[model samples]
Target: MRPARTTVATAVAAVAALTAVTGCADKTDAASGGKGGPAVHVTAKDDSCAVSTASFAAGHVQLAVENQGSRVTEVELLFPDGRIATERENLGPGTRATVTAEVKAGTYNIACIPGMKGQGIRKKVTVTGGTAERRDPAKDAAVDAYRAYAQAQADATLPKVKTFTDAVRAGDIPAARKAFAPSRVGWERTEPVAESFGDIDPKTDTRADGLEDGQKWTGWHALEKQLWQDKKLSADSKALADQLDKDLADWQQRVGRAEITPTSMANGAKELLDEVATNKITGEEDRYSHTDLSDFQANVDGAQKAYELLKPVARKNDPALSAELDKQFAAIDTLLAKYHDSHSSDGFVAYTKVAPAQRKQLSDGVNALAEPLSKLAAAVVK
Candidate 1:
């Protein structure tokens, strides 16, 4: 790999296999439903699920999610294998939205994606008297594609992390800083799957500012603080770097076992865009190192990879959406490329170098891509 400063920082693993999630087409809802079921009204507070009822008769049920919190939020019906029966995204405060879905006689969860980020909060809901279709992992080409994509990301991540950690352990602060943002690219792209694993996500990705009172801040942000803010590394910093490498290696083993599906690929793509809108484009994340642009490019690349894998399925299921996504992804890619590094064709300019107007252009591009991506989950879950 090129030296950190010379690397273009695109997650190279994506393009090679992004096309693998092709041809698992026929996903249909063949489940039997009882008489039309009742509407279940749900209230999403900042951190709570105030459900009108936790039990319902299994049939065509209506789910209404009202966002009572300050930040934007969404609601999803969690099915096994990462399938979402129905979901509503980006509902603002005091707003309500609903989705009609065929539900079966089984226990399900009302997943509240508060602030439209993180793992989301889940509330259990049960239904009775009808049957639900079970998803076969074996038949899901998209899931296979997703698992492979994750493995690629992990494999890509370890070496980058090792480079960064080695720099830190060697007390080479400048070299470590140069390597930091690029190293985080793969993991950030695979976040939809990575964050699902217990504890590891928080341990590795949590923002120093977002840490709970008692939480020991680790991961990229912790290291970012030391490298960019403190501007030096000590023995404890070396240990932190080593721990990050170890954690990523351990997490790579869990990548293959991750739940990947057409629905997951679609949702993960949308969520990665959310990360861009929520943080990266704002220049908030890499405040210390000014590496936000690299991360921004990485996030976009990650989302595009997922979109690429699901494109064939989406085209079969919903051609209009597929076309729109195609256009949006292409436009965003072009806009981002304007910031490409002169020295490294694959790398981009420093985040600090981006002008305010160009930043808006990038943000607008991301928002445009996000709108189409938001519709992807519903379109590909055929």
Candidate 2:
């Protein structure tokens, strides 16, 4: 799910005002330290976003985020136009997570969203003092390849979504039911990219609970409820189906233009694992249809695909991390395979049937993988 965003005009105006503050443009203090560069420390509380320093030297910067808030919070490093450079979400109260993002010498924001909704509390930051990086040719190749992969995933999703939507338009409950989980596989695989487009994800994937005050509930989950829980099509079903197709088509066309870098790929992989743990494993994502396992597997597949692409760099930089990641990923895969269902169209038993103990195991496996996966961004950019 997409978190609430800062508006472009608001962000731009804030950035402009912050640009005039000489203190924000000053060099980072030595007390703000990290291994290879200054790591910006962010303390996200219920009402404020606090940063250790307003500026840092350009390169790979680590954000060590701690949520001191009562509500679950998220911290993001956003570009001036509100595109995510890198972000860590679903951070429960008092929990800590690290996000590493590649930043050039420029202005950016450190946004803390308490409750993971509404216009977030924003702080302007200056990424100061660095010349253009002479990036490794191999890393450039990885970015290109990942871009192709994202585009391919979008291409594959369109027709599958069409099948589902077509079934919806025709009032074929059984066909829509069968097509629902299958249609979402490709989207789940590259969700971070789709999410980067901002408006598209909310329209196509937001859950009933994730909606804003005035936002309409559409997308796969909304349709899923109609087909499974309500057991009949509503008058709005066809219009909603058409809207899904159009929103997705917009994603397919715009995905090629998404801002993808090696660090973003590595970070996106970690985000996928988080998606599984926070949403899919809890069975909240597919509560109506009980197809959470299908999403579970797809998220793992996406994360693995990213790891595979970045493996050469990560292996070279930190071979031990590479080894640990490989072992943990296999563990997750093995655990998930226990739920495979040959009879199901999506190849997994209904998530509703998973026992509490079994769900805890899945959650544990995801956390194990997440720790190492979180290190991937820092490793790749090194």
Query: Which number leads on TM-score?
Result: 2
lDDT by residue for model 1 (168-268), tens? 88888878877887798888778767755545776787766555557776777788888888877655897788789878888888888764656557667
For this target, which candidate reaches the highest lDDT against the unseen true structure? 2
Between which residue pairs do clashes occur in model 1? 8-347, 27-382, 143-260
Q: Which lDDT tens digits does candidate 2 get at residues 1-382? A: 7532244543333222222211211122233333566568899999999998898887777787787888667788888877788887766566665677777788989999997876689999998876567769888888999999999999999999999999999999999999999999999999999877667888898878788899899999899999999999999999999999999999999998898988899989988977776667656678799999999899999999999999999999999999999999999999999999999989999998899899878877877887778778878877
Model 2 stretches astray by more than 4 angstroms: 2-35
Query: In order, how many clashes per candidate?
Result: 3, 0
The positional error of residue 44 in candidate 2, measured at the CA in angstroms, is 1.2
Candidate 2 has which clashing residue pairs, if any? none
